[model samples]
Target: MIRRTRHVPQIASSEITPETVWLNRRNLIKAAAAGTMATTLPTLASQTPDLKPLSYVPGECDGCAAEEALTPLEDATSYNNFYEFGTDKSDPAEYAHNMTIDPWSVEVSGLVNKPGKLNLEDVLSGFDLEERVYRFRCVEAWSMVVPWIGFPLADLLQRFEPTADARYVAFKTLYRPKEMRGTRSFTSVIDWPYREGLRLDEAMHPLTLMAVGLYGKTLPNQNGAPLRLVVPWKYGFKSIKSIVSIELTDQQPKTSWQELAAQEYGFFSNVNPEVDHPRWSQRYERRLPSSLFKPNRVPTQLFNGYADQVASLYTGMDLKKYY
Candidate 1:
């Protein structure tokens, strides 16, 4: 029998239906905020210069047909995965304050007809913010809900006008190990200057976001300060942080995890409870800041519990092998 806890929702096992899997707007918002709170805020509190409580209101599920979708960011900036500037999560939060990001430029090239380094301000000024509540599953087996504010990747790509030749979108993270101490670690398993990608379709999905911030504050450096990708249904690794470049290409881009272990990290790293990690079960995850005396492990869900909105995207694909 499939065992479930109090927080886990019940589902019909007869078929994989999108209508049944999608979260309502209100619940989506709750999950997003909760997830962010669980993953980011603890670290943020330690590194945040002001130690101020950022502006945030309760979020609601947006017609997702699910109850209580929102989740808070546990530690806004103190996330433990700041590989963009360095490997340790706290390293970026501390070292990134010195980064002069105002004169930033992003190179958009490869299969695109128009290729050049674009000003960061110009790129940022062009979009509107949309609050998307999504389930976040970290590779280490923790999870949260995050109400991300950003526009769809497709909306941004439309402006660039990718040629039909474009089949992939590759993102490059900022590499400054001298300033970021985590990169200097000799025993680090992850490569410096992390990279990530998506099939053209995944990149263009309405749920995918090119995020600049969370919890209504400027994105803290440790949390992919300038720009990051948010692929809700996939594992957090798919969401590359602190991106400095975005290249549209005919061939698939090399990603950090896939490079480390192709068999373990697929190009599409969607979260599926049915498939267990090599050393752990993906069936459940621990929410950060969990009560010391109580149960902390939260159940994992299909499509990270956003299947209702994105299940169709992977209709006939074999998730077990790809995962």
Candidate 2:
């Protein structure tokens, strides 16, 4: 049977969160003002120097599940998938602050009309940044709700004016050897300078975002500071972090996961409960901050619960085949 994603009503600010949690956050802010880190702050997080909270306008599903409590700031920042720093969830938050992002540049080439290394500042100079609260579903069956700040990726891609031959968008993560612990791992399986891709259409979708911050602040290094992709409908890995290159091409680019184990990882990697991972079931996800005794398993939603907006993009393709 086919399932349709539901559209929740616009939640009023008054009904968005429980009074108790709000009070708790309020108190935590007070503590932060007194030089103590807020309890809700992500673990091992470091404040980016001279960075201020970014301003944003809400998206279409602005209040999606607004009534549900957000994952604590500490947990989201401390836990991560940044293998560059290390494999452990806490590795990024602990080690990422050592890396650098200032004066960053992204090389844009391949089928694009304008091809050169563009400065990150110039790219977002006059763009209107916005905040989008999205459900983050990982292939590992753990999830979090994140308020990402950025503009639609399409807005940036359009600047290059993709040619007719540009059918796919490829991205590459930064490669810093001495500074990145994982890069020097002799026993690691992942290739350095991680790569990812999306079909041209998916890259241009309104829902696709190139995020620079989260929780209204400058993005933490561990969370792909400076630049990252946010393909909400796909598993978290699809959103490559610390992007340094974006290549538009007609031929399908080789993604890191696919190169490592094509049988296990696909190019699409869309969130589909009906399809199970090779070693585990994808039907349910563990809401994060969960411990051993309490798994907090919740039914996984199709397209990470954005099927209503993105399902049409797949048309006649079989998700299982592509996924």
Candidate 3:
């Protein structure tokens, strides 16, 4: 059954750490370790110097029915599928720290009028960031509710002025074999740079976001620090991370997974419980933070429970065929 509830409650302002306090997080951690501080904050120990407290308007869960529990920070950061770092779930958390993110830039080309290279600061400074509490569903049938800090992707794309010929938007992840161990690994199945795409309308959808951070802090290396894409209703793989280029194209770009295994991974990888994967059923999902004693499995909702907002986009189309 589909569950319906009011938007998730907003995070209290008191819970937000001030910019000064966040900047001095390391010192605070040291003080806590030395017993100089009366109250020791455990989360502070994981904070990196690059992470800054983002300024954003709190998000409302528009069509939600219940307050979804957020996955623990440790779980979210440690368990990931960034093939660039390694194939193992725990690999990204262990090796992603070796990559450099500060000198990052995104090259916007193809059908856009204002095609140029944009530095990380320029990308963030041009828009007003917002916080979105979204349900993140993976193609593997595991899920998590994440609080992401980002701006609408449409807002950024509009600035580039896509031409009339532009029908699709393509994204590419940064590829540095020297730093990204998986890229150099002989066992890797992916091409050099990971690629993903979306139809123009899908790219412009309000729910599509360019995430820079999570949990009120700048993103960790394993979590796609500096920049990443977040499309709430789609499977997690569609939201590619460590983006380095965005191209407006007329042809349907060949995505990484589709090229590797077309039957298993479709180009439009929407979350449809009715469409079972070739090897497994998609009828249910295991919510993260589950234990062997409490499996925490639940029926999977169509479009990951955003059907009211996005179902119209697929009207008169064959989801089973397209999927």
Candidate 4:
């Protein structure tokens, strides 16, 4: 069942509502309490996840340009990926504006010498956020090119200075259920408080970004609010949202989907159309808003069409096995 806060607006409510909804003070307290408990788990302990101020330049393409022509971040961030709040892509946009960001920080722990919580400003002020045009391919069989403004994850990790023991980097999301109503439901396929990981090399890759904002504005709550990762060559899920904690460890980190199905989701989920998932074929994908009248679908590409820049990174290794 989808549990909503006790506070109800004058508008009608069924199982779901697309409009912005507010929760009662009592319900808000309960939600915050629940979120606090969720954070206690080792999985959710990040410093703080809040949107950092950023500037954006429209009509710029840096890394992946083929799909860059599709849509801009202003539309992309405001219009999609609201399933964390509800099934409606726009629900987070409506309900999440109320999200309290700032006073935010993320905890960097695990295999690092400097393992401590740092404020959002401390994190953002450390680097120059550059523009990168990367193709984002979702597991739902849809694709888009986004012009993201952020610095590389490797650059950030280098600042923290990881020990030799650091082998994989794990990331966690903020676990507030009241604001993220999707977690309050029983139907979600994702684990509560989503998590993701990358091997040390991948984490340090120039292509991996610890994004602060997009489209010349602070990232909207629906689009990760504070911090999210952007890995151009992998599936979108690998780029976890609402990052609160970054942990470096010697052991292979347990990513959310990989834990759900080891056989189906390899540690390195490289995009490969040749290797189809047992449940569905990865050979093709539907573009977003697959219009009822004119459904347009396109074939999936190996390495998400960034094979030139990233394929060599996995040289001599069987991507099928690592995938």
lDDT of each: 0.70, 0.83, 0.85, 0.72
Instruction: Give per-candidate clash totals.
Output: 51, 3, 3, 10
TM-score of each: 0.77, 0.85, 0.85, 0.77
Task: For model 4, name the residue pairs that clash.
Answer: 46-107, 46-244, 46-245, 47-105, 47-106, 47-107, 48-105, 48-106, 50-226, 51-226
- Tens-digit lDDT track of model 1 for 1-323: 99768786767775553331242334445646767435543333234342222343333444222243445454445555765445655655555655445567777877777777767676567677655566678877886666666667887787778999999999988776765566667877877677889999989877788876676655655666667888878889899877788899899888988999887788888889988878778888876645668657888889888888778888888989777
Judging by TM-score against the true structure, name the best candidate. 3
Candidate 1, residue 135: the lDDT equals: 65
Report the lDDT tens digits of candidate 3 across residue range 95-197.
Answer: 7877789899999899999998889998777788888888888999999888888888998899899999999999999999999999999977898699999
Screening candidate 3 with a backbone cut-off below 3 angstroms (N, C-alpha, C), the clashing residue pairs are 4-65, 5-64, 5-65
| Per-residue C-alpha lDDT of model 4 across residues 1-323, encoded as one tens digit per residue | 99888876665456453233232334335646767535322111111123345754432334534543655443465455645677775566555655566668788988887788878787667777676767788776777777667778887788788999899999988877876677788978878677889999888876788877765556667677677898878888898887889999898878878878888888788888987777888999776545677665778889888787688789999877788
* Model 4 spans with C-alpha error above 4 angstroms: 1-53, 56-67, 72-75
Task: Name the candidate that leads on lDDT.
Answer: 3
